[model samples]
Target: MARILLADDDEATRDLVKRALETDGHTVSITQDGAEALDTLTSAAATFDVLVSDVHMPGLDGVALAKRAIAAAPDLKLLLMSGFAEELDRAQALKSANLGVIIKPFTLDQIRAAVRALLA
Candidate 1:
């Protein structure tokens, strides 16, 4: 199973995504804020196969966190999720950051598919 760090400011959405990922045989670590998510990635003992984070959040946001995570672990895989379609345009901005993104309001199937594709 892949270890996934799930960061979302919304508790319900985080829980839902966590459950879905876990159900798909992924080990998920849930974080409520971007700062905490970045902390986990920067920690010396931190370990995660992939990161799934919301685009908008307090104290850093997913893009910033992804940048930091990539610096910390260049081989790390990232999956960013956002409710804003405008953020998709920023995908190019993340090219050097080494990350993939998904628009919000996505289905469990979509998430699972993304995860599978990344893991593959």
Candidate 2:
């Protein structure tokens, strides 16, 4: 199973997604905002197969988090999710391997498939 870091400002959203991902057998460490997420990623405990973050969050935002994380772990896989997914900067996705953007309002199955696809 893949190890994952999940970030979102919405508690409900984070909880729901984290539960879904965990149910899929991935080890997920979750944070309430992008800044906390970045801190977790840069910390010594930051060993993860992928980062699933909400595109719009306070302090850092998902794009900035992605940049910082890639600088720290270039081969790290990234998955960005948002209601305004199109507003996400695609440049980061191009720079990282296994990067994907998933639109919000997704079903559990959809999110599971997206993460599995990243691992595959």
Candidate 3:
């Protein structure tokens, strides 16, 4: 089980992901946007094992959030989601052993698998 921080603008997506991960026994904390997610991360007393975020958001985007999240917690694992090819490409620069990207409209299994891979 892992502690997961999930951020997305869409309520359905957020709920879907939170439930999906929670079913796997992970403790999930959700946020509506990148800015809120970052705030939660920085303020959290306990460290989260993973961050699952949507690439696009109102206040701050996932890519920027990822960068700051890593700086705040170097060991944190990241999974960035986006439907746009360009947005996915932008995240590629941040790719590493601890980072991954998932195309949006993903099946529940796909997202679960992606997070599992990061945890692994």
List where candidate 3 sits over 4 angstroms from the true fold.
Answer: none
lDDT per residue for candidate 1 within 1-120, as digits (tens), equals 999999999998998888889998999998998899988888888899999989889888888888888888888888989878777667548785447788889998898888877778
Q: What's the CA error at residue 107 for candidate 1, in Å?
A: 0.8
lDDT ranking, high to low: 3, 2, 1
Rank order by TM-score, top first?
Answer: 3, 1, 2
Backbone clash count for every predicted candidate, in the order shown: 0, 0, 0
Q: Model 3 scores what on Cα lDDT?
A: 0.92
If scored against the real structure, what TM-score would every candidate get? 0.93, 0.92, 0.96
Span of 10 residues, lowest total lDDT, candidate 3: 38-47
What TM-score does candidate 1 reach?
A: 0.93
Model 3 TM-score is: 0.96
Model 1 CA deviation exceeding 4 Å by range: 96-98
For candidate 2, the 10 contiguous residues with the lowest summed lDDT are 85-94
Question: Which lDDT values do the candidates have, in the order given?
Answer: 0.85, 0.86, 0.92
Q: Which candidate should be chosen as best, given lDDT against the real structure?
A: 3
Model 2, 8: alpha-carbon shift in Å?
0.2
